[model samples]
Target: MKRGVEEIVPGTPPKSEEEVIEARASFRKQYRFPPENNNLTAAQTRKVRLIYEIDITLSEQIDALSQLAKLNLAIRNILPPETWESVASIPDLSSQQVSLKVLDSLYAVRNNLSRSGELARRETRRTDRNLDLATRSYERAEKQRMDFEDRTGAEDSNSSIVTDRETAALASQAAEEKLALRRLQSRLAQAELALVDNKIERFQPFLADHRLRVIFSPEHVQEQIGAFSAKEADLEKSLLASQEQFDQLTPNAPVSTGLVAAEVTPGETVRQLAQSYGRDAAHARVSLNQSWINHLNIQRQFYGHRVDFYQNKIKRRQMSEITRELDLEIQRLESETDYLRNRMAQARQDAVRIGDQFAGTTGISPQLIQSLQDAAQEIVETLRMEALSTESTLSRLRNFNDELLNRTSGYTWHEIQAILGDRLPLAWNYQLFILNDRAFRVSTLFWVVFLVVIGFFFARYISRTAGSLLTSKAHLAPGVSAAYEKLVLYLLVVVICILIFNLFNFSLTSLTVVSGVLALAVGFGSQEVLKNFISGIILLIERPVHKGDLIEMDGRILKVESIGLRSTQVLDFDNSQKIVPNSLLLENVITNWTLSDNILRSTIPVGVAYGSPTRKTAEVLLEATRSTEGVLASPEPFALFSDFGDSALGFTIYFWTNTADRLKISSEARHRIAEALATENIAISFPQHDVHLDSLNPIRVELSRQS
Candidate 1:
């Protein structure tokens, strides 16, 4: 028992004798010992004495009792004393309970330690993953920053080189300008000398001609000048009279004086009298003779009393010489003006050429130079802003690159190559890094042009295919067959073009953004063009009217010719073609005669005297329509007694004709009706009214008074 208690406590020693005695008495009621024959035997006492010695206390009895007491106290502390006695009644509880309590404490401690270890392992793994991802992100960012820095540095170098070249070119241009100014001064001096020489050479000849004209044949010159002036005056008067007659005469009126004279002549045939006028007898004699007579009469009435006819003739002759001299002087002045104009034009061209050269040397655009300098100022401002932005970005990139280089200084080129192998070819990696150090503008331009060429060819192919498809007329409704086919082809081409753009790596999202901006610009810039495009699409889809339909739009009756993307062409009633914007047709109301069906009804109205039978007239008109070649027979021609006028009965001949032959059928039918009416002895009415008057009582009263 002592050994068992020792096992529970492990290395703990036994308690004192006084404590044992008290313990035995306290535990006696709660604890039980093994049953014997009624009392303790000598062997059991000896065994108890041996257990007490092994327990290592001052008195064996006291030690055994103290151990029992300690066990009782332990039990009472753990459980109620009443339950403890029941629990301890079972054998070996002191040892078993102590062992179980030790095991429970050990298991609790082990579980806590294991949980702590697991938490530490998870935290380590999480930390390692975070560090790795951060390292990769930092490395990628560093590479991008280095690339940007290298590009910026190269651009700065190029800009500096361009500036140096521009400065040198400007200096050269200044020198050239100075030399050109000196040459212009020398040429002006030479021109002044040449003008003086020319004046001296021409002066003597001019004086000689003036002297001869004044001295020799003065009277003859005067007579010739007077005769020429009189003839010119007569011609002017005739011309004025002819113009006045033309203005006063109607288009259908007689135009010749000779024709009028023939009409008035007695016992002369009209043809013979007319032939006596001129070879162009019909035109010369028809109406102009009357005009000439009226003009002569007006002149005699207005100016005959003021001057003698012969004296007036002499005055006009003198005026002719003066007019001739004045004309000569005017001609000379005009020649001089023409020469001056040509010289001025040449000077302007020279100035323009010089200005263009100056612009080229200075790397300035001529249009910008001519824009009053405002554009140049704006360009300079823009450049300054761009430079500042570029400089700031370059500095940031440089700083980032420096940080990257410091962090990765220990890494080898092979290590970088390995990391970036997936993105770039292994052989090209070194080349790419070296090329990144200088300007890569040439390579960028080459790629840009390559992409543009690809896009251009793709667009061309789509446009050609679409144009061919639209022009074909295979698949469409009967009413809008031609137009619908064309529209489908056009839409397909556009869709294919958009798909080709997508194939070239252009995203719909980016295209949408660009289209939105362009739409805003177009809305503000060209509203009419936008309206036409939208209207054209609507017209193609709705097909309210179509090609070949007879329609009237904007008061113009025409046959639809062609419907294009932007405009519609129509042939008018007069056979003239007009191109109308699609927007106008879509927005305005139009009359379509053959939209639904090709058969059209045309009406021809005729009036006969009221004495004629209305039924007979209707029958004659219908017979006339039936005989017409283009009139339709299935619907059968008919006529109606439409109305009764004051002098005549109005009848309308109704006939059906194909829309294409509507005009021809109407015209022919009218002609046939006129012939039929003539055969029937029915007279056509004219606009005529008769008035009757009566005199009442006055005549009879006057006669009675006279008798």
Candidate 2:
């Protein structure tokens, strides 16, 4: 093949001065006021100036009249005089030929009129401001022209300067005239707007007079029902169409590599093919997103219309049978609306997943990926708007239903039951499917959360009440009461979990599979937690180191406050609470102060001088134990001469007390012993040592006295 050569093109030449001038003149001729012709003689310039002034004035008038005509037509179309007159003349809607549809039309007309009036007033104000500025400019220009004429009289020689002043004055005058015309147009629009409003005002009182009658009329109610039903059907059809389109739109398929290899493919050709494929794929995705957004919007409109239809049905609930039917419809609508909300959420998620999968593929540039993301963002915004619209419509319907329910007392228990069921589906009867082959709903999840929260508090209250009853009525030990309470709570939790699983319709086989997977995960990643959990179960069953037991661990005395599944809470002597893991408590050595009984023997060691009366000191120690509070009386406090030291005799006081305050008891015993020893004139010993000097020579003793 011969090599191909690139073609080169020559650039265009620049325009000549005369051509440039002609182009500029043509452009200026298109505008309202063409630029001044400097080449003209003084007479021609004066004639052209006069003709331009007259043309501007005529154009201004034409524009003003055209604007006023358009405004009048718009107001007339928005609210026809016949419709307004018919509404105004009819005092009783039931007696007149007007239907609810006609009233609704009038309502729309009033809204349009109000909006038009407001917009007209705003335009009038804007025109007034512009006219003020234009009037000032014209006055200034005219004054300057007059001053120039006064200084240089009619016989002045400088005709050019005088011409310039006259031209300035004419231009300013033209601007003033245009603004004056705009002001007139704005005034005429306001006048027309007020006429429509006055017509609407006449109907306003009639509307108020027949408001209740219009609302309760069976014919009008049926009309609303039919209209809403038709709207819903139309939206449903459109939604189905959009969904079909979205489903049919698939991403561009990849080119066959075998076919490409069989053909003689150039690198540039392959690149172009790849680029086209990527662009087609991206475009397909954007179209799919747009289609899906349209589908969601239509689906949302259907939901809103259905809700409105059901709410409108409530107005005709005069009979018991009809009221019951209306209630069922309301419940069905609520459930359907909830289902739609969840489906929309799932659809949004699916769209995102599709975009993510596309983004991960090769042969796609960053720009293509960014474009896909932007499309997805637009889809999100569309969905958000649809949701807001649905919410607003549904909120109004719900409020209206609630107000009707409150105002009427004809509703039976079935109606109340239906309303409550609609408001709160706590019975878990409503089934909303999220995933195919499995029925799940956002409302179900919400109910689960609500029930769990309420159940949690309820369980806590029941457990505490049971614990109190076991402690007070049955006279059970605190540890036993706590263990029973915890067992009750855990059982309740297990029951809640089972109920939740049942709500999901999970089979035993599925739960077993899930359990096996969780067990494997626990064995690998949660050994400590598993160990602690099992240890806690053992502790709860075995009742070791239970609540209200005073125990010493890690050289610190602590009181057991509560026992939990994975950890035990204990209060230290310093009044701070600490959490000790169940496994740690099981493995570490702990000293239980009151394991079998609340009473425990505590000893206090005291030393006295090689004394005159050791027996007296013993009696005093025993009396001290008797005097101190929280010291048990049945065990019989006693003192023993336990040991002898180099300078004093060691005495120990032994006593039994149920009180966990060992520090307070011991301190009190020591104080009593010292006071009694002092009162009996028995000396307490301090550390004393005797020193001996041994030397071969005679030892000399010297005593020094200070004056």
- Best-performing candidate as measured by lDDT: 2
RMSD of each: 64.7, 26.7
Provide the TM-score for each candidate, comma-separated: 0.34, 0.39
Candidate 1 displacement at residue 430 in angstroms: 24
The digit string of per-residue lDDT tens for model 1 on 104-123 reads 23323333334444654455
lDDT score, candidate 1: 0.51
The deviation in Å at residue 113 for candidate 2 is 37
Which residue runs of candidate 2 sit more than 4 Å off their true CA positions? 1-436, 700-707
lDDT of 2: 0.63
- Among the numbered candidates, top TM-score falls to 2
Clashes, model 1: 12
Q: Output the worst ten-in-a-row residue range by lDDT, candidate 1.
A: 302-311
